[model samples]
Target chain A: MDLSALGSCVSQVSCVVTQTTSGLISGMLLFLVSCGLTLIFGVLGVVNFAHGSLYMLGAFFAYTVYVPTHSFALAILAGAVGTGLFGIVFERFFISRVYGSDVLMQLLVCYAFVLILDDVVKMVWGASYLSMGMPEAFMVPPLFIAGGVVPPFYLFLIGISALFGLALWLLMARTRFGKVVRAAAQNGDMVAALGIRTPYVFAAVFALGSVMAGAAGALAAPVRSLTAGMGFSVLIESFIVTVIGGMGSIVGALVASILLGLIQSFGAIGFPLFTDGLMFTFMAVVLIVKPTGLFGQRVR
Target chain B: MQAKGTIRHGVSRRAALKGAGALTLASGIGGFPHIAKAAGKVIRVGMNTILSGRVALVGTSSSNAARLVIDKFNAEGGAGGRTIELVVRDSKGRPDEAARVVRDLMDVEGCEIILDSEASSGAFAVHEVMRTRGVLCIHTNSETSQLTADPKMHIPTVFRSARQGIQDAVGGGQYAAAIAKKKKLTRWMTCSPDYVYGRDNTAQFMEYAKIFDPAIRLVEGAWPKLFQPDYTPVITKILQEKPQALYSALWGGDLSAFIDQGNLYGLFHNIDTFAVNLGDYSVLKAVKSLPKGLHSGSRYNRIVPHSAANEAFYTAYTKRFPGQWPTNWSWQNATGAAFMCDALKKTGGKTDGKLLAAAIAGRTIKSPFGVKGTITMRAEDHTIIDYAVAYGITEPVDPYLTDIQMADWGAILEHEAEWKKKKGYA
Candidate 1:
């Protein structure tokens, strides 16, 4: 090939690499947000609309912690723990009362939480948007991979998300709490008959789901502007991801998030305006093909 | 009225009280006629702006500026001894919500005047409500040209107290085109939000850029969702295309996020990024690594007007809100409040919508941000004119902007009128 043709080939390769990395970066954040959303559905059999609000709270907590400590790692931990603790309290007071109740009641309760938390956030953080910015560790130079300019922070995001997914998998698969949680999800009455203290397990599961969302929010805080409506978009996107992945499937959430992320990244390049609609279309197609989702089980 | 300001010319405390007492006798508090009630009456002005969404900083600045102006006016015994009271409400950046809030403000809250600081998204809705309600309204932050420029959309009671997109487009195009000429940059790209304000601003800016620099070719236009959490895809696409220059109309949190994300990809290193909204001190200062030499239109930097009045306004604003510099919305709302106060003074503190609007039309108010110490409410369009329209290169340090280039108002007017005619708005 001639010099110009070679240059064109290189440019195409560059475009692919950059777009792929962008997709992964977005996908990882999506996975973190939706994994919890799906888990609530999976274990509790309740659609927690409050998930996104909790995620927003996590970001605020992270900001509150990060501002004083000036440590991103510590902030991430604080976000997770802060949200996890709140989740426990919420489950104890609100979610607990709605167990075995109508789905509408559960939904109403969670929606109420969303409104209350929204106001609480506004009262605390004020109405203005905020940015965490990158900590010093994540402020390194961009890494060039095959003519693609990738921020090292992007790589860190991908790495951290993977680690989180692995740790979550281990917690669910290898630990005794994971076993009890899975068992409780399968047959809460049977476990109660066996005297496993299922209420405690339920609270643990809810808090665990919240922790995942908090970590995602904390991770996203650096990359995205924090605002009162920040979680609204994420919640919508995560719902789509959860639906496509199967509402109860962790592995499905991961796969769907990555796929949707890639689609969004490339769709932005090809059809910038329709990128928002493309994912919805994808979800529609998925629903048509598999109403139960890719890995979703039948209704409880 | 020619320069010092509309009503700021040597009006002392005693003189204001005297004028107030005289107006009370002459007007009898616009037919209230009860001395006790008239002495305690206040003109209520309502504000509906984004206070909880992506652009909440705009509302914060706007409300703060309104308070600054209103408090000063109230302290001076208001317009002829009547105090002006500001009632601020958050629109939350939704159009439907803005309309609802505005209706509530007018009907339930009994606000005689409205100072709207919504972006174009919500401002359009506010416009419809104002048209229906016939409330005297000053759009303080809605920069969309059609808000005032279009005759069909005109309400005699409504006036724009902020810069219009066409003016910025003309001024910015002229500013950016000069550098493009010097650097011989022919290829350009745009990444404005996918909305009316964004599309119109970007297209107008590019049209004028191509006009000034004939060699310019717009390679592509990337339209991002407003308040989108990420701009990586947009950045990557721009990087792939490798345009010599890029322009975006994203503002507030979106702009801050875009800049932060772009910095990651080294997007601005080689590209001459000209973002119209980047000059807001909060947004500019918030960028993690604000790339130096980024071109932007003046958005309430105290240095741009380079006048004592402008400096004084900035100093006072900063003093009022410690450690917080005013955004573009601050001065626009300040000017809007000033316009209202001056008009009220002219009308002997009458709250009639048409009467107040008539007083506003074809009048100039003294502004720290004015080109020649005053900005005019044009009689034709009811939009502010002669406000300093400028562009500058950004820095990474304090003041955050340098190499200021002022846009010629004559050229701006000539092109704007042409643009208006082309759009059939004239």
Candidate 2:
């Protein structure tokens, strides 16, 4: 390439690098939301269609609770804890019956959950967009990059995701609860036969997963506006990330999420409009190439 | 009036005192029950828009517009001192959900006045409920003449701020036809979204062009289903048709996708002109690049009019909401809000639904666009006959504006009038 052309390309590459960092931050948020979705799907073996709504609930909870407490830390905790309780109730009352059912039945059951949750939200929050002021700390101007301003909170988002990942990894790998859950996921029948209370493990995992999603949403609220359907978008992306990362695989989720984030970051510059579609396109490619995803194992 | 109120309604003195207190506390309440009874008299404005999903951009914008207007009015001490609470529901662009929203807003929310969405079907659904109640509906952005034409749908309080799909087609078709003829282009083709709004818009344009030049051949016409992400197939069909000009009603994401594909195929250099309706700021913000010399139709252009209202609104709006400016959709929202405010101001803050509706019906509220257009709420159909603006692409700007120039609203309105007259429909 000519010198001027080469220089432009380098500039473009550097720009992509900056966006990729932002995308990684975004990916971390995605993982927090998607981790719960995959866990619920794996433990209960049912797709939780209302997981997105739970994410939205997390944000709303944060918005309301944080306003009174005036603490971002408390707001994040409220989002997680509140959604965790909601998830437990959801799993015990609504999801427990749908377990071990046909895929179609499973889907229908979740569909019903979606309807019930939507009405409940309508009753509680009413039918209006409610926004809250970003906390004083998160309001700090973002870091500068390539003639563009990057919100510092995005960096905070990355840090939070990493912390969640480390904590999740250690808990699952080291704790007795994690051991029981792992065995249940691998062989529910054997775990149940051993009198390990697999059902309780299932419920706990569902609640824990939802809490992670809620925390992610609480963090995301300051970065972007929250609306009723806000959870729906994240739900789709989280599913994609989980599937590409290998269902029920934490390590796989981390790798796939970061990779997808980089792909999206560059995609936006190359194609601003289609950047929304780019994540789906990437999922399609990965699924087609590996079918089992990057870290997925064959059932046999 | 006092004796008549007591005798006819049989309201006792104790009940009257309670009612008075209810009126005083209307602005402070946020929940359903409280908001419903706030200001002692509750007038709920139910809004249905694409609040989530892929189409949330426009919906979010609509919600924000509603919020800004409601907040502004409430701050001014509310309409007739009756708290006007806006109850919003997301339709997710489904007809069934939209119908539910309409039902819930009317039956549950106790909204005396309703705001219809940008989606045609959603507006029609809400229009049904509003017709039954004989309540005024300030249509923020939906563009369907069918709602106004149906007699069963008197749409008692329904007033549209933006031009109808029919008007867009009429304005866009003539502009494309005239430009094609002037440039010695012969054949023309159209590729619009396959829905009432898109179909009605593109078809109207083509039909009028046929009326103008009978000898001209319609080389090809493609109607892609609404929200069809992949336009490569449609683009292939358009290229194969080899028409001298291309006319489309692609808006939002579909419009953005079409422009990207169109530029890739060197269509801009090949075609005489590509006229698009609703192809303004939202579409411009989505795309990274645009093919040079594209034509677009719009309602409000920031650069079109240099009026006081326009300057004040534009300056404040841009400053408050950085990276998001008022587009055609946003402009319609601002215009609707401005008109509502004007009517309220005229009535001395009296928000009696019927009285406000009548005041708006005969009034010509000044628009932020600075066009001294009479927004007459037609007593016959209850539709607001508003003006349209169209523009063409000249250059690209960084971070935004890669596509098209702002068409002057006056030019488009004048063209629309001439077309209406020519068709003997004026």
Give the TM-score, chain B only, in order for the candidates: 0.88, 0.80
What is the fraction of true interface contacts found in candidate 1? 0.66
**Total clashing residue pairs per candidate?**
2, 14
> Which CAPRI tier for candidate 2?
incorrect
Model 1 clash tally, residue pairs: 2
Model 2, runs deviating above 4 Å: A1-101, A105-300, B1-44, B77-83, B273-275, B306-308, B398-426
Candidate 2 lDDT tens digits, B70-110: 67778777766655677788888787788787667666666
Measured over all alpha carbons after superposition, the RMSD of each candidate to the real structure, in angstroms, is 10.1, 13.0
Return the number of clashes found in candidate 2: 14
lDDT (10s digit) by residue, model 1, range A134-166: 888877768889877789999998999988888
True contacts kept of each: 0.66, 0.01
Q: Which stretches in model 1 have alpha-carbon errors above 4 Å?
A: A1-11, B1-41, B94-110, B128-135, B352-355
Clashing pairs in 1: B5-B366, B20-B80
